[model samples]
Target chain A: MAHTPFERIWDRHVVKDYGDGRSLVFIDRHFLQEATSGRAFDRLRAENLPVRRPDLTVGTIDHSISTLPGRTLHSFAAGVARNVAMHKNCADFGVRLFSIDSPHHGIVHVAGPNLGFAIPGSTYVCGDSHTASCGGVGAWAWGIGTSEVMQVLATQSLILRKPRTMRATFNGRLSKGVYAKDMILALIGRYGIEAGVGHTVQYAGPAISALSVEGRMTVANMSIEFGARGGLVGADDTTFEYLHGRELAPKGAEWDRAVADWRRLYDLGDAMFDREIEIDCSTLGPQVSWGTTPQDVIGVNETIPDPSSIADPTRKAMTERAIDYVGLTPGTPIAGTPIDVAFIGSCTNGRLSDLEAAAAIAKGRKVAPHVKALVVPGAAHVKAAAEAAGLDKIFIEAGFEWREAGCSMCVAAGGDIVPPGQRSMSTSNRNFEGRQGPGSRTHLASPAMVAAAAIAGCIADVRTMMH
Target chain B: MEKFTVLTGVAAPIAMPNISTDLIAPSHFPGKKPEEAIVMSFKDKLFANLRYFPDGTPKPDFVLDSPRYQGARILLTGENFGCGSSRETAVWSLQEAGIACVIAPSFGDIFHDNSFQNGFLPLRVPADDIDRLTKGLARTNASELTVDLEKRELRVSGMAPIAFDLPDNRRIPLMEGLDQLRFMLRSADDIAAYENRASTERPWSFAAAGG
Candidate 1:
């Protein structure tokens, strides 16, 4: 019987099946960040359980670190102590850590993949919802909670029930200004957020194949937003090309062998999936979230949905609450909605290509006087590459603050936040209540869309500014 | 983790959909030290935004604040409760606030997994059962409900008992207060054998940690 990519990878990782629904699955790589790993490490020490495999684990400082210029350990007083705790924990546990001063330090999800730690046909785990971003390389990656993190630290294995499989095929060619961010948002908007629950989604078809590795990461990063624990894109020539010369990637003869093995990681023609859905990308427009939930999204040309028109009582109530919280009227058009801030960075869209796309729009243009715009690279290497490509100057000249690498503004940590009751155009994944800060409303969009909105001082269509 | 074989207590209703973990445990809590927040009891921080004013006074209108549901141990809410973010702090806060079970049509996948690890029951009953329970509680002014894990039954004041399904693996752990890590460690030999075989089969996976 032919097996799908998810099945093949999952079957390879099972150490033992308990005859019940649970199975002991092996974890290939584990990435840790400051905020979630401190308690897990403390617990490990308290229990006198040594890390099962220190070589398979790596840590980075990202979640709570400041992104301001000349940032030091003491830049953010609240985060300083946590950073100290993380350093001590990682040192005591014999795990390699990329501290705040390290050149490789960045968001774990971003830096892990960029460093070639997430290889094809491997299993990766992190204590972050966006760990699925590493699945761009065809790895079986998912996020876990703190307790599960402790489990990984002590045992390097987790007892997990196999999830059902779903194949989401994006067919047809993407239109200009429409991107992976738009594609994923359109999917969540059409299908409710719970559509991917109880399943691992495999993103396939022509559109997925055409996306760059970074673009694929952007789509997979939001898998948690739609309630999926994991999402993967099968490895191909494009994936191998992206991994070829990366730091932790296999060397010479080993690289050739790795590539040959990765080539077999795709699904066979007769592979089976529990559920399948196809989405057409030819007619898709740039997407922007208008409400708290990612499912509450619309195309750039569409208007905000009215709660009264919704039939389901639960949906109607949710919509009404979202609209009230976001401070938007039911029938108002989403395009002209004013925004007080424009942020372009996160694990979702903080890569080099994302910065280039945003910079392309910001070049030869000035941000509207009222909008406070900033661009934060996802990783230190990404920051260096963007600066080498002259993207930083373009953004700075366009009135967008070019900041250090971190998860700035996206999580409202390290003192970077959108003020209360103000609206922001952000490239981050979640737009839940006070996600960016207390009472701060966020509109999720692509990096290019955020750049256009920053220039226009409102939610604007990126296509209009293109060319 | 506490054992949760059975629970009988007041169930409060909050009829909002997609109650994200961010709402349950906000990232920013004034006057709380960041480093100590993780180990501290989040009882007062549960639903801080919705439950408190800017000046730090409790909002009396919030469901958990209402005098009738002050000690509620079960939460009856809409679909997709505990959605967004994999922060286990959300479960910790709810547990600290005296909530032992949450009855919703569905829950976020990560949050569901986190609940099992903490011995908290995230029960998924049909929408009709929730509707019936809400109406029954309102009509009779009897908010007490019993969740019997052994029988897999939910009993309310006036309605017929509703049966729910939980996997045996998850159910057994919660019933016995078993430590999953300790249990998995018992099979260390199996894990070692698997790893050795995997290293030979996929040598690329064990390559150096850094570039």
Candidate 2:
């Protein structure tokens, strides 16, 4: 049968089909974090359910853990009890947890791939939405709620309704200073946020193939922002090269056999998607969200869109509200909009390559005096590697605060937050109202764009600074 | 879980698009207990940023805060409601605020799944139907709406009942207040058999952690 990669992976994992669009799909890997896992663990204890496959499940403390240097579990007082609970729960359940002191400790999405746990052609489930980041390596991955988390914990499976398939082909090559972030932001901006709802998006074509695995992770990480449960690129030599010798990846003969099998995991020649969209990346610019929604985005040089010009009343109203929330004038260009903060990390853009790109821009320039710029690595290993390569020196010398790894201000649950009414240029995925903090306004951009903004003290084009 | 067969209550209109889970339940609660932060007691924080000012005073202009919409049990809003983030806390907040159902043209995929797991109904109707309901509420003196899950129809004052579509699999669980975990446990034997086959078929998937 000619099938898409999604259908191929999904067909292999069906444990039982209820014949009503619901199937008990076996999960290959499960990643858990503190914020959403506490309740799931508590429920498991209440029901006296044992973790079916403890070896396949891994836990970490990222969501609420403070990214402060020399930090302990007690550093963030509010997060302390949750971190404690995670440790206790993982210990009691025989699940391996990367605690605060573990070098493996980091954001679940980042650590999963770094540790080689997100194997190609396998099924991955996590409690956090960005678990789709694993799909960068060609895994079938998606996020689940705490109740679904309990389902995975007790049985190593989930009762999932098969989602329709959509293919987003990014044709042509991205111009210089444009990146995977811009490619994805441009797609969401062009297609509206709900375009991928009820579907798993497969990112293909020349531009997607050009992206490094880390860059593809940045693209896949934001799939949820567009209402897609999962997004992925098919495995190729690039993917195999990235996963070849990682910590938990299959070794020697197993590796050869796994690669041989993964090579056959792509869509068949006659495969057809339920929906298809093509994005020409050659003309795409470094995109920045001018308003609250990711869909309310414009190129760095573009002006804010006026709501009155919109034809659809609902979209017009949404534009008006977004503009009001973001405090932007309709005719003003997005480039010169002053920012009070610059954040350069999240599961979206917090990787070694992301750091390298930001460092290239921050090499000799100082951050603007009015801006408080921060660079939080996605994982401890990423932090260690960056420091080893002197990327930390480039950032610190540029007046950016180089911090430990975790989901810092991307989600303000860890007490790291942008203040009320302050505008920030961020590399994180979402720009929803109060997403960074209550009344905090955010402009989503690429890591290079954020670094350029930090230097210029506003949302500026990275190409201008590249030279 | 509470079984919801029929819910008849005041329906409030929030016409804004993309009412994100972050707006429904803000993430900036300081000094909250871990369990409290994760699962329960978020009624006051429901739409905290939109419903109240930074001074902790209610925003009277907000529909949820207005006197007419007090104790509203149904929310009629724009498309893509509960978009962004896979936080189940958003569902908990709406449930705590006495909202039994949310009628929208569309929803965030994760939020939709989360709603069903909690036995909360997330109704999807055509955009035209939403417009008719929005207009019907504006022209009428009464704003009460009746959602009959068993019959798959929505009844509003002075308007013909609108038929809705919900998959039987989702509807039956919510109506029966069935726990999904117990239901999944029944397939343990099937899962075990599948695992036995998968062990040889995909050995790399079960590679020991930290290998």
Candidate 3:
């Protein structure tokens, strides 16, 4: 039967049936991060279970390594130890690990695709929740839990319940300033984050067609925010081009063969979809999360949100709770809420491009005094590549801390905490209350936007930072 | 690294619903290095106060470090335990604290898998059965409950049995101390065969050739 990339990947990795509700999927590729796998590796030795399929897995340290300029092993000792442990765990499991020293190492999400670990018509799993990022390459990738980590380590298979399917189509061209992130945030706004619970979503449309691979990754990575099982895109020229010559990609005549096969990974003319959402991206923009959830958001030009304006009681209640906690009021514009901190990295948008964008904004501009900002490199290689171009120095000269490559404030790990009651703008995927630190309010934005916020000490339009 | 222990007990006794992983282990750590920075991120940032971070104050609504269950072994929780992000650290932190198993009406899909693989028996019991234990605790103001991991049964002291769902594949693996990663690594020969074949069939797949 003809199939889309999602269907092809699904069929190849299916191992068993768990009734109609669920099926067993054999993992084709597995990725591990420092935060999740450290203990899991220890568990395997304790249980005497070897991390099987070491050849199918890879590791990279991103979360705790600082993004500060002149990031040295001697400076961030705790973070350095985590990277060391990640390297150790990968070695123990026989999975290839990319360390701080590896030029290829960066955010695992970006690193995996850049290294071509995520292939068309395949299955992938990662210890990181944003493993969905692999979907950008047309793979059926999903995040796994620690216990699942143990299971994957032992068997490289997962018994997964089939999530209901949703086909979200983005037709029409996206207007300027509107991004894939804005498109997703807008979709979630229409269908609350939980709308797609227990379902897989297919991003199809002219708008999706227009997105860069990184933008597609941004779209898919937020699938979890809406509680979806996963998100996927069909393979096309864009997909193949991104994979072309990647460090771990197919080479020479074999590359031609691979492309020929990948080109076929798209929906047949009469393909079926369980549900559909058509979004006109002509009005999307620099989106900002206004409330606690990804769904609770507004366009960058909108206000802080008036809970009373929402019709749904649940939404209203949620907004009320968020407004009370975030210290925002109705009729107050969200674009200038005043931030005390600003961050520009995470699995969602912490790519080299993101750093470049943020640095462009901070190149000659200075960070606001009250805003203690940090520009974290999602991966070590990203750190190095940026520094090779002296991006780190620009951030530091502008008062931004260039720290290690581990997940920092975005996850609250490695002592990366934003003080409570402090409002800040971040580029991470989630803006859940206290997700950064206890009572620390986070408003998610793009890297450039985050840099703009750092400069203004509050939410500001990226377009305004053009100078 | 010091070894984590499993608590041997008779029955489960948590009373809340939707015991999320954020409560078990939040997604504070997402990178490969930086283990130390992550482990202590929420040590004092109790579940209740996760909403008020950076203030370093507890909201008191979180249950991770509540006084009521200070020394409890079997975590009898509400439905959908670990229902959040797929953070394995949650399982590690719980296991490190000697929580051998978590008995709830349901568990988050990823968390359940992580828990089982990490040697944490996430027992899925009926809501009614869980209610019975909750009521018993409420009446007696007691929270101590035991779960027998080997038998896959939950029995309160002097109380009748409370049945729980156990993934069939997990039975022997948990008992024999096996996990998917470990199992594959053990069958290096089989994995190598698959890798070699995958490379030959799809020579373009770098991961296959690298393996």
Best by DockQ: 1
The reply for model 1, stretches above 4 Å from the true place, is: B30-41, B53-58
- Of 2 and 3, the candidate ranking higher by DockQ: 2
Task: Residues B21-42, candidate 3: write the lDDT tens digits.
Answer: 6645554332222343344644
- State the lDDT of candidate 2 residue by residue for A240-357, as single tens digits: 9999998889999999999999988874477899999999998998999998988878899999998888998777888888899889999888888899999999999999999999
For all candidates in order, the CA lDDT equals: 0.88, 0.89, 0.70
What's model 2's TM-score? 0.97
Per-residue lDDT for B28 in model 3? 39
Q: What is model 3's DockQ versus the real complex? A: 0.27
Error of 3 at B2 (Å): 21
Write candidate 1's Cα lDDT for B121-190 as tens digits: 9999888889988888887666899999999999887788889988788888999988887799898999
Tens-digit lDDT track for model 2 on B81-161? Answer: 999888898998899889989999889889999999998999998889988988888787668889999999988888999
Each candidate's TM vs. the true structure? 0.97, 0.97, 0.80
Task: Report clash pairs, candidate 2.
Answer: none
lDDT, candidate 2, equals 0.89
